[model samples]
Target: MTEPILPRIRPEIAALAPYKQGRQAGPDAFKLSSNENPFDPLPSVVSALQSATPINRYPDAAATRLRERLASRYGVGSDQVHVASGSVAILYQLVQAVASVGDEVIYAWRSFEAYPGLPLVAGATGIPVPLTEDSRHDLDAMADAVTERTRAILVCTPNNPTGPIVTSAEFEAFVARVPADVLIILDEAYAEFVTAEDAVDGLAERVYEQHPNVVVLRTFSKAYGLAGLRVGYAIGHTAVLNAARATGIPLSVTAAAETAALASLDAEAELLQRVAVLVERRTTVIAALRAQGWDVPDSQANFVWLPTGERTDEVAAVFLDADIVVRPFSGDGIRISVGEHESVEKVLQAAQSVVERRQ
Candidate 1:
């Protein structure tokens, strides 16, 4: 019998490795890898989910109600919002909507881990601009990297892995330099944890009002303690929102997730208070880490980064041995999520022991 022939696939798709999430080894272990909110979901949100009926039925395709709520909260019209399973899903859809074969997408290197893959999946070139020495987005360098083929640019404020925000002034100047036709995606997944006075405020509100090509993505996962529920939304010009919505899978977001997200918005004040506590814990941890002579950055997110280089593996191993799971970035650093006081203490103890042993 003749051998069966297989169809050829896109080269980029074949070359990509699956994205690995942070390690969570045991039920008892404190997971400080995913930068998730350590708090439990609000009582009201839980109640809303419990009371949700006919979950067997499909969710609204457009997620009209949740979009309306988000629109009102963000001071935008419902038509300008697009809801999805998560911010990542919205990102993928946005990329697909705008980018095509031979097009280029630019973002800061060592930012969100998912960013590099988004462009690859969309059949576009992924151009990662190296971050500044402080591990912040070098907006001028990113702008200079743009070519005629560039289709989109992604900016992750209070950036992932190394957490520092792009100030409002910096963002304004960068936006002025970019071409209007090139879409700018502002990923604000950690916006709630930011304490910087000059940090970009209501970026979606400002972008949607003034810049037609600017899109802001937000999530209910981080500050809202809804990571498990997986609800996120994007705000942009109505045209761009519609295009992103077009690329999304129908009913990708569940009815229960929508219910929880809506309820979370109602409980926003309480959730933000918890975020404040995490920020305070982050401050304490950073100071302690610096006192111990570790090279750390000024983090604006709910995580701390250690630029451990070749020692990243060692540091992660120490935490794992202490039953604290921290995220280790290859050849870069380790990111430890700020949990509650107890978890933070465990991390501190593990870090102290690791530093002492290394010395």
Candidate 2:
């Protein structure tokens, strides 16, 4: 049988590779590919999920209660909070609402793997400004990349895959340079992991309220260990969030997810203590990597960036062979998430092997 010639797919999308998530690990393998919380769910979260009522009914389409809880926690109004299936879904909504054909969404290259696709899905051009050699966002260059056709700017703090954050002072200056009309999304998916003294805390900075065009995207997937629930939120101006809301899938947040999120918030102190442990583990991993002659970046997130450069794929295979899973960006680097304590030793062992082979 002959295949149909005109699938009529958009040429740009047709040529694009589908977004690749971190590789799943086998039974005996330690999965450190995704920057996910390593801890098991809090007792409170499990209790909430088990106690969820009316599973047959549709969730509150607006996630109203969760929004109110988050707004109060973040010191914002409920109208300013937007919760969705996940932060990625929020990103699509924001992009679709703000960008269209010929419009542009600008973000740093080697940042979040998801940012590029959001614009493509929205029929907007994606302008990926290169990250600095040190694997940090070049905000000055990013600000300069903005043009009349640019509709949005995505800023990923403690940027995914690469762990460095945009400092508070740097971000404030960069925001000052961006036009107030363009949407600025501060994707802080890994915010809870950042222990740095100088990183920009978008929620704490009150940039969402101070800058009408800015929005902050956060997720329960990372620090809260609720990745399986797919609940995340955005804090923005009421009007701006409404535009995103218009583009979202209705009733995307499930009752189970809503319940888990509320419970997680109730257990915030305990969860953050786990975050502190991961922070300490990350520090040790970075130190070990450096001592092994690998020039790894200081990661504020729950992952370390290994600039394997041209040997990225080769280095990734080494870790895989060691029964360790890690995310590899071909021709660029690998992102190794901080995982179980045993996994840390395995990661360091692999790093040592890689360094020895290179030397």
Give residue 76's lDDT in candidate 2 (0 to 100): 80
User: TM-score for every candidate vs. truth?
Assistant: 0.96, 0.98
CA shift of 136, model 1, Å? 0.4
> Candidate 1 on 248-272: residue-level lDDT in tens?
9988988898999888888889999
Alpha carbon RMSD to native, model 1: 1.7
CA RMSD per model (angstroms): 1.7, 1.1
Residue 321 Cα positional deviation in candidate 2, in Å, after optimal superposition: 0.8
TM-score of 2: 0.98
Model 1 TM-score relative to the real fold: 0.96
Among all windows of 10 consecutive residues in model 2, the one with the lowest summed lDDT is 51-60
Candidate 2 CA-lDDT value: 0.92
